[model samples]
Target: MISSAPVIILHGGAGYWEGKNLDSVNSALREASRRGFEEFRRGSSIEAVVEAISFMEDSGVFDAGKGSVKNSEGEVEMDAGIMDGKTLSAGSVVLVRTGSPIRKALEVMKKGKHVIIAERKGNSNTTFNSGKGGDTVGAVALDLEGRIVAGTSTGGISGKEPGRIGDSPIPGAGFYATERVGVSSTGIGEVILRVLPAKEVDTLVSMGILLDDALNSVVNKVSRMFGKGNIGMIGVSKYGDVSAHFNTKGMPRCYQNKEKIQCLVFDGDFS
Candidate 1:
């Protein structure tokens, strides 16, 4: 039988939005927490975490769903990915709009045959372009049933040229999950593309590094690979160990839960 403990993780993205309204950020945290705990209470699988986060991704409140960033040409492009740890199944979508790209990625994983990559198109209704304007967010969750899933959604890089798709919708970069570990990320898309922080972290854990140390290594590597940009991630091990890390001046927000829930915001000054 599976353990009664469930875990959920969330990220708000990485950037220089220091003076932005704190209330809005708090509200987003509340929303994320609500969805996360609801899934736990229902004894749902990791899929429920994806469904709950998809609501946030589609809410236009944070930066993953409706208010995501725009490219250099002022058009919105999106990316998303999902992975199921138990089955090693994964799916990803890029450069489309309409339905949630993360959801589409999960569908692809479930279908288990095709690799779905949304091509860049002028029309913004494709699954890849649905949540431009910084509306993109990423998630990783493990349910009481011991199922794990990871997902990410993003509106491309800020000021990016039209048709420029980042790694968030790509597996291994923005999100990754396995029976041994779970991962999700947020930060500069271009940087994320190069380092593939989420998967790298998982690899470290597999190599016998402790979960917290593994996460730190990935965060430090990201900082070394891409200078000055913020990157944050959360991970949970098969042993129920939880860890999170960030390399920027400030990481907006991150949360986790096993028995009780906790929310963290790392702003500049470490106070």
Candidate 2:
């Protein structure tokens, strides 16, 4: 039987942070940590973690969900993805206006589709309306039952043209997951789309590289291709090992635990 220890991970949207208040951001990080821990304690699967994180993402206070960035046209376009490691199944939606793209993506995954991108123009459905501000957020969970799942969501690039879409909601870009490894990222959408960093990291893991090393290799490659700057990711391996890395000035705070919750924030120089 699989062990009963549950693990949950989350990310605030990824972007350039120059003048933002560190204390306030830390508080938000703590809150997300609390929610994640609580869900884990409640016997909730990674699905619950994704739903709770979506609450954080939807709260206009962060750069995702309702408060997501506006395109050059001043409109929001969103993207998201979800994967079930146990089943090796995944789903994604892109350029959508839904509130919780992550959950919608999970629904699609349960329906047996490997990928499901939300159409810009399609028959009106409430699922497509869940992502309000085009913000993207992602989540991954590993329950004591040994089932793993991953998800990603985003608001499209700031100042992008009306139809411009990045890789946040793409399966291989913003996030990737499998029973063996899990990956999630935040940064330049174009660069992510071009290289499919998340899946690349998974491939590295499949090739026997440790999760942290795989993440570093992928981030380094993207940095070189897109110019070294603020690209970052948070990932956990199948063994419940966690690591965070970035190629730019700094990445935001994140926390993890199977015992008690802890939040780690980096506001200083990248090292």
lDDT leader? 1
Question: Candidate 2: deviation at residue 193, Å?
Answer: 1.3
Across 212-241, the per-residue lDDT of candidate 2 in tens digits comes to: 788889888887877876467777677777
Q: Candidate 1 at 155: error in angstroms? A: 0.7
- The segments of candidate 1 whose C-alpha lies over 4 angstroms from its true place after superposition are 1-4, 41-43, 119-136, 256-258, 267-271
What digit string (tens of lDDT, one per residue) describes model 1 on residues 120-154? 47565533333333334766677777777777777
Give lDDT: candidate 1, residue 252.
51
lDDT of each: 0.68, 0.65
Candidate that scores best on TM-score? 1
TM-score of each: 0.86, 0.84
Give the TM-score (vs. native) of candidate 2. 0.84
lDDT of 2 at 45: 50
